[model samples]
Target: MPGEDMAGGAADTGPEEWADARLRGGADAQAAQDPPETVRHTGPPAPGMVINARYELVAPVGHGGMGEVWKAYDTKLRRFVALKGLLDRNAMTGASQAEAMARARREAQAIAKIEHPNVVTVHDQVETDSQVWIVMKLLDARSLAEVLRSEETLTVPRAARIGLQILQGLRAVHAADVVHRDVKPHNVVVGEDGQAILVDFGIATFDGALAVTQAGAVIGTPEYLAPELFDSSAHGPRTATPASDLWALGVTLYEMTEGRTPFPGPNAWEVQVTIDTSPVPPFQYAGPLAPVIEGLLTRDPRQRLNAPEAEAMLQRLLDPRAAIAPTPSAPPPEPDPVPVRRRAPRGRRAGALALGAVLLAGAGWFALPLPGDDPDEKDGKRAGSGGSGTRERWKDTHPLLKIGVKDDQPGLSKFDPKTRTYAGYDIDLAYEIAERMGYARDEVDFTTVATDYRSTALKVKLVDLVIASYSITEERKTAPPTGYSVDFAGPYFEASRGFLVREKSSRYDIEDTSDLQTLQVEVCTARDSTYEKWLPEAGFKLVESPPNTYQDCLDKLLDRSSDIYAVATDDVILAGYVKENPGKVRQLENVGGAEGYGVGMRPKSPLLKSEVCASLKDIMSGQVWEDLYRKNLSPLTDRKNPPGLPDLTECEVQSAGP
Candidate 1:
């Protein structure tokens, strides 16, 4: 076989050359495939060395702008692995190889620190033949870019949920003070298990450290570059901040919903300039995502909304009563057809009939069916003719004080055998409130409620309190189930329903309605507050699934079946993906508005409300709430925990937007 056989026109070479061209960017270059230089490699298996104490010399996986990644297997581990070789191989002069090797080691160490469900794992790193070899978890999936090229855009809700997961991955890395300077679609991985994992921390930088990039040596793919990354002055004299990552995330969402970047140009330089100077337009998307996108893509990084604010915004968008603007679209033209129409009947007649008994009953009205009550259960639960006897039962033990939790949310399990206790955030919180009311934890009965049936259980008095990360809304507050009123506690943790996609996605530039026809968007559900109201108004033909959580949508995006996913902004599920695969999934921007998680009690239970609120006040004012907040949210919130807005901490702040 020719040396350049698989190198792509990489050598003006053929099919194999196609692979090489993909790696090197051209035919005759010898340097790695970095921009401005295209390099191709002659086939060769290095002559000396032991890998996993077996599997002798083999050829390179392929060469690229950065370096060459080899495909190999470990005889001992009995699995395939990818080994990455730095840009310069045996040709390094002096101690450069050693320095590169050190860098490789540092990268491995940094990767090791990240443990999440969506991150790719690093297995080993070694110095061989004057070159550095970094072995990483192998994946059978195609590059996110290739997948997008084939599948294009994904649904909106799916994109939003996936976006949230990506933020999670970034949160882990950011918590370690590392910045993934290069975030875009190509770096994300959609695993066989259908989760988007962030991969390739090759260009990541530690916060506050001198940039490894030389002057005029811009890093990262062009499309997802934050305006600040391109021109620090563009974002008020800052080079890049955590907010920059969010700006890039906004671009990613744009690409997913519009099927193209919000800013596009013929060349990288032009694209970078556009990114730095241009502004994203206001356009509605298939749900209530416009506001969410606006916050994510804000050019002024400082003015842009933070993750918590974004998360809260999304929760509100998830509300069912949040009205969506109607989709503005031209009516379909009348079809050309053959005319064989039928005429209407010319006449009709009717005769009045007399009743045999000639008896009339009084006219009466029937009430409309209430939301959660089944007809069968309603009749049986009706108050007895002896009203006084029934009233006492409802008033004393306070049947309304009983709180119920739904099983749909994660970490809400009833009990764990290993722990031998009722474990989960909700379980603990609910029991704490009950204890404050002077009731034993056991007094708060546990009954598994499916997410679909949760509301029904509430209407029937099956449970008194619901602490299942539920948000209190005006609609639910106004007309509650008979005798029940809705009361809330501290917003606690904030969250949102936003978009998730590959970091460098073309959708990054999508900030308006100017480009909606080219993308494929997936949504979690049609009833999702954001998408239901916004997508139609923005003029999108939405493809939605039955009601599902953010994670469900994430799984779809990772499978490459959906381009975008929607979920709580606070979810930051991307952390799991990054942990599972390493640096792939990411948030484009928050697609919705601020919403809070609160303790829901029947409005009728003033005693419960006052008692629970007092406990909350103490917690919020003291170390207990801080400890809990730190425990569950330190990864992302510790650094920027919002200060003293006791009133706004978990409460909704209404704002007007286009």
Candidate 2:
């Protein structure tokens, strides 16, 4: 209802209105503290004042946790525009100011490129009397938040219509590879002309970009948050897919129809609890529209109804279709329960051993996980909840800790099928972790995992941990957190992504090809790299290939099939291959990307994450981390200025809250 809040709350900087508080517990409570009529009015540009010489502010429209929304007139265009500016811009300094500026820039960048009939349009971002302002499309219509606030609830057909329109905007947003992280009712504007527009790209996440969030929490409204978001269990990287946004859409529909939040609670944390553990309550008023709501609200992201699917269902409601499922003659057979199997790894290189640099603390050195245990919960309560749980029984049942590593990665993990042995930086670190667990090198089991399949292995309990060069991203962390059931630890190493080309091929070199928009070169990269998704959008003629492994991409370049290979992955990986191939391949020093290597684990292993995080921090800060780098990666990397590892603080479990 207030102006699109990309900058954080008054207390902190980030998209505050719904960004930080919805993820942690801020906005609503913070707003309640301040009276509704409160206007920051800290400095210049009072009502009717002109800003940036062109826009004349008619009046202050609304004020909330984020900033202030102003109704203004664009003098040049002779049309109205919403001049959104920060309330406390003139009064802030230090980190807060820097954070606000970053959020503002991010919002402008995110929305400026998008053009959809159902999305709010951004005209320009300008500096007005020392305060930054974003000029956006003005809508005289009431927000969906206001609509509900005025008339408690809407009929099923009306709710369905609004949802369908929202889905149309979402289709365009996701098509542009953006995840509208915040999708609450307040952000949706419904015009009097019957047009519904999805507004606020302030917290939307694009590929390779991290959403600025409250330091220890997810960044979205907890009530509308998908169950996958409440996943502290899988302490790994979080990713929010299209289904996540759809889940919020489902929540919005429910709220519109029922006049209340589907998962209602006084606090964000309590809302998360209900979403994670509770089943969907029957919507008495839903009638024929019940199926759409239930399908979209499914807990498991994998099984949840997607945007297109929900769109079709809502479309059917808007324009009734003849399609209907006939009643089954008999009850369907129950799906076989998936068994959690923990076993001693198969196909071991017998007698292969590693030495733990030190002895473990004691029998309790390993993590003891309490399933569904909230990080904020007391230890005593967790201890008494589950008797001899899986974490507790890990040692007794499975003697060795099963760790998954990549089969072909050079510097990270390289498995030798002939010798049945594993080597490289990841292997060494796994041994280091195992030693800390009071086990011999052979006591830990090693399993081969493909890059894309690692999440599955961890989810199914096929592996206890993954030490591959996995880049810990916001998307990976939140992508169906509860459903995937995995955790992450230690960014023990930091690498940069760069381009590799033949030494003589000046045309494919980074220096030779500056402008991507006008460039004429073919680019090939590994299938799993994020660059594969965003590169074409940036104007690169990508070479598609079957089985896009790092080796495959390299082979394509060597075979003269592709002019260049662009992988936003480990620089050391490219370095190793380049060195081995001599003058044939060279890395483009200018093309660089950040790639932090973190270890992956399964859900319900917060203690494991905590323990691994400590080890990773030690490996990152202490001499052991350096020694491993020198021994395994230094020969191929830039030894003089080796890349520094990322801060493991982000991976640390926040027992308190975001």
Candidate 3:
């Protein structure tokens, strides 16, 4: 087994002897590549002289596409280490070989110079008669890809955090002008401490060495390659851009979230075409992972969110009410407790620039009022504080906190008679937050928008949070950098944009959406916005029209104004308008697959937001969360009840409380 572990100990035989035996025994294809003597050296190196006796190879740890990795002991320092070797045949070729060696040397230099927790530190690089090797810190855990295969699946937030950590490492590499062109699951090794250590920069190249690659030799795994790889440029399949790594990361995320790649095929070629030509499947069928997939799979590179953007989304998904604002470690207080200043007005560009800088510097706390009733009571009130005091007082009462959800209905905030207030799932979540913060349910203002306005509303500061079952992903989070924040909760309900046709309509015979032809599509404004980017890529003609709520779409179907109603199933289920409506509506059997719903918030609202997250966590800790489901959402519960945990203690609530 090529991947099997080679345990600790000294073999009585030398490298050449073992290699000859293995070759004669016909060991694996990998063994066939190594000369018998090289194969003998494959196992942990027996005591050996290296670089005039400064270092020694102790054991072989692992092997990959390029070479074998060894666990070595540094004789001078009395410490353990990892040594990587490049023994691939092409490394000994002509000019291409020299270019490869130069690239390898650059990667070694880059890894050695950089210092980051997530990045594996390369200690030294050395070349032997038959190999090029890099000495690095020995990692104790398996590759992340292996860990995932063993563990099967991880919670969305958990996986996202791991991904963000990996991105952070990649960011450092990119900062050094190194693109980890081979970013993939196997390259990320999970250490014993549960941190992700980015490893194997074997094919990584500095920006200066991008031209080293030969045509037709893809530097990355086909499944993870970016669509731009198909571009007939000198730069291999996918051009080696920092963004290309991000795209691979997106594919990694999609696979982890959904338990399968967004584009799957029997072989790599089919997958490559799908990557370059197909739209990512909707995440609605992904259950709890829906929001995570959407965020990571955004197609546009500029729009592809990276570490900082991903960190925000992960933190939110993990703890929704986490302060949306970036919380850098606070600095020491200003001398003599000078009164805090106000954000400069936008009229003076310098003032706005300074204000923005101050906020980013974590001095925004000085601009926001502390948890106090009035500013006049502070000792510095007399020090030209009136102007700042008035604004701070007003802001305390009217914190720019708000949530905008996507709704196409004429009156989205209709009161629910069953719950005795505005009580859709989205409303309930938002209402609970507002109620705890001393606002009547109705005090939380409602603003309706088409799907496209979702990002715009957040960017313009028209909304502080969006709880309208929005799908969260890495791509969307980066759309308006520092504008929107997504923290996912219970995916609560499943939703997707699928075709619904009249039972008697001529197109009713159309089974899957792919089967429909020359058809008029009736879509709610919200559904249209989501599908506009996805459906056309899937090859469908989208008939643009005025926005309609799910109920309106159903009505239009009965009236025969449109041929098919494409809408989210949740809206369809909630509207109850599709119930036995003269056989006018039936969801396509294999149409839109799975997608999920999540809460979205502005990037800056941390105060009440963290509190809201605490409340949700609190609810999820006990039967209250499950009861919300057992009462209202029976269809979603697992067939076998998940084993219950210890009951929530008062301290748990207090500790978890925002």
Best by lDDT: 2
Best by the TM-score measure: 3
Compute each candidate's TM-score over C-alphas: 0.43, 0.45, 0.46
Of the two candidates 2 and 3, the one with more favorable TM-score, higher being better, is 3
Report residue 456 deviation for candidate 2 (angstroms): 18
| Lowest lDDT block of 10, candidate 2 | 352-361
Candidate 2 deviant stretches above 4 angstroms: 1-45, 86-92, 95-99, 206-210, 234-241, 320-658
Model 1: worst 10 consecutive residues (lDDT sum): 348-357
Question: What value does the lDDT take at residue 61 in candidate 3?
Answer: 70
Clashes of 2: 21
Indicate the TM-score of model 3.
0.46
* Candidate 3, 517-546: lDDT as tens digits: 445344443332444456556666554643
Off by over 4 Å in 1: 1-62, 86-95, 207-210, 236-238, 282-286, 310-658
For each of the candidates, the C-alpha root-mean-square deviation to the true structure, in angstroms, is 21.8, 21.4, 23.4
lDDT by residue for model 2 over 536-569, one digit each (tens)? 7766666653233666677766765554544434
